[model samples]
Target: MKNHFKIYISFLILFGLTSCSKLLEEVPKSQVNKDQFYQNEAQCIAGLNGCYDNLTDIFTHNLFKINEGSSDLAFWALDDADASFAISPANPGVGDIIWTAAYHGVMVCNATIVGINKSPVAEGRKKSLVAEAVTLRALYYYVLTSMFGDVPFYTKEVANFDDLEEITKLGRMPASDTRNYLIKDLAEYAPALPQIKTSLIVGNRVSASLAYILIAKMAMWEKKYDVALPALQKIMGIYGSLQSYKLVDILFRNKNIEESILEVQFAWSATGIRKTTLVAAITTPPRTANTSIYDGVEILELGDKANPSTSITPSDHLIDIFNKYPNDIREKIVMARDYNDKWFNRPSRDNFEGKPWMGPKFWAIQMDNKLDGNNQKVFRYADALLMAAECYNEIGNEAEALRYINMTKIRANIPILEVYPGKQSFFEELMDERGRELMGEYGRKWDLVRWGIFYDSINNTIATENEKIKANLRPYHEFYPIPDEEVFRSKGVLTNDAYKQ
Candidate 1:
């Protein structure tokens, strides 16, 4: 129980502060109520825990469906709306879940920040606590503006009925403006946080390392390489040696490894107190027997629940790229053609169907009740290194860029490139490298969108069997539509103009 005590508190905070209805419309029903909470350091810290709790909600099964399953790395084998690019404002598929959760996170972070400021905690302690909340708020906003452009942005806590009314009338803020605000805000407050490894405490807490990475990521989205380079360099100074991290075959198998800068913490509990993740259940092919190639691996009939007709699988396009570089160690780690001693779409190993399931990197060895305690890696030092390489390449320093890219290539035991392609070509290779290294971890869709090639990328998959993706994808789909419920609640303040025909 001692091991799960923090998990329990985070779960409590998750249910207490977040609402599925209109954002900030309901009064919290948990032990920590905003009306009479945060009187001391303990209460302030609890409030901040609520802010961290929201991260679990944001990086959920739905996010996986939209972010990775819809991208080139993986695909929904079934005719899922998101997989087929059939998402819309009215029928948002999983977009509504992601949209609602991100905004709820922002609201919880805002309330926590305000409560911490008003609390009587020591000045130094208060500053650090508030920095955590602010950093978390920036993350929520980043997800918001990334997924749904021009979201209804707000920083004020909805403390009273009047404040709630004002929130209802708020209009959508430009995504650029929101990113700029968060970049500047994090720059000022993130330094106040002590330099601690986020791998501590199961990688659930915010630290300066994660903060700088977030700053660099958002800046990269806006093409502000100058701002991004320094932020990435800050992380490089701390973790550049690459001695502590590795290209481990199965990353999430051990939670909070040194490679992880941030992870969405999950735990297994019989009572199901928001302690488990649906990742393995959704990603792997469903099975009922224990015929796994590895000893003591238990298979479950859980993978097809999210899409009952079919399971999520690695795309042929991804496999083709992996085959392009046979020496790439990540190929077997990221995908497998056999499961339960039987090849995918085949009765047994002797029969050959080339379909591949998501590899052991994502499987939960002994998943319980169709769920597992796999902590989702939200940020890792490997990605930071790649981003550093990208920033350097963008800033016309090809030598520095190759140095960082080679770090990953060497770790994977793959041959490193000595010749630098020109800037544009180098970026294209970086894109594929990111897909190769970070496939299952969220960011594929966002990467395509950031590179202005989402529509083209999805269309390219049509040469294989992604006809639905090509037919349904639109230019404006670079940004997902806002949930209709949110627009309705905003009473026209939040218009889905980009999605309008």
Candidate 2:
């Protein structure tokens, strides 16, 4: 009973307390119950863990679907909601999924902050807990604004049903306001977080290094290279070098590695608080019951035959890039051509043939074949290096930019260029480098969007392959539609005019 209660409390924070309707219906009683339930440091920490669990939910599904699927890196086998840009206020697929999940995470963080402030824990412990909550809240908002453009932002915990009316009436905050608020929150609380966690189990928790990475990313989005450089330098000062290329494969299998700034942890267990990640199931190609061959090559057993659903596949452009730079070590680790061939030969029943490349970064040989224990990486040290190179280049420090970019290329076992010729050429190289390095890691769409090239990039890469995709994409498609439920609930105060149907 005690063990069950512990699990219940640790995981229950985000359930039933998500939507505005539920907020009005259940928050008063839920808060009253939790007020009595949470009083000590252990309980407070458990609540904080609950907040982190929402991140797992966010990245495990829709967030990746929207971020990576919509990018030139990938496309869906079927008519996926966000991938096709078919989202509307009426049918807000990724928008609804991510919007609900992110705000639920924010709500949990807000509750934790309010509760922890009133707790009897030591001041130092209290400070750390609050710092983590604040940092996480900032991240939730960052994702929200990044995806949905403008979002309903709030800091207060909904402790009672009475708060519902005011909350539902709130309009979408401007994107600049949202970014500034997040920057302020992160800057204030980042120093309070520890530089490194004491143990691996708690490694996924917020740290000063992770906070700086988020800050740098947000600054880069605003084209404030000056603000981003210091944060990138802070990360380099803390963790001096990138994890070696030889260990790149091992980096995904293991947790709390030097390369991983933050990752959502999953345990391979039949019954546990943390089960397996969905990446394995979603990314892995379906195997055949009988062994098959294509062009004298045996088909790779990428995943289980019984569980056959490869919803997302790598783009042909991605494969061409890898082929163009065959020496790049990331190609072997990030994708498998054999798996793609297998899928191509034995196409799915829906006539969805696989692309030339498939993501294999999170593939695990599951013993039970139920779920995979692979962790979903959020921020990586390589990303820091790439961002650093961009910042340096923007600041006209071509020498410094090459220095950082070369570190990544050297680690990839690729030859480094001696000169970049000009800034435009260098920027193009950086774009390709980012695509090669960060493909299938869920940052591609936003990366292109931030660079103001999403539309052109998509049309240029995919128009020849699928004219329908080129026709579907619009300038406003860069920002997803606000969810219909949210707009209806807000009584037109919150609306995405571009997606109105």
Tell me, by lDDT, which candidate is best: 1
Candidate 1 colliding pairs: none
lDDT of 1: 0.74
lDDT (10s digit) by residue, model 1, range 206-264: 88887898899899999999999888888777665765566773356678776777788
- Candidate 2, residue 180: CA error in Å? 1.2
Candidate 2, residue 296: Cα displacement in angstroms equals 8.9
Off by over 4 Å in 1: 1-35, 201-203, 271-274, 289-309, 338-353
- lDDT for each of the candidates? 0.74, 0.71
Residue 411 in model 2: lDDT: 82
**Candidates' TM-scores?**
0.88, 0.87
lDDT of 2 by residue, 439-476 (tens): 76768888888999988888877544665676677778
Q: Pick the candidate with the highest TM-score.
A: 1
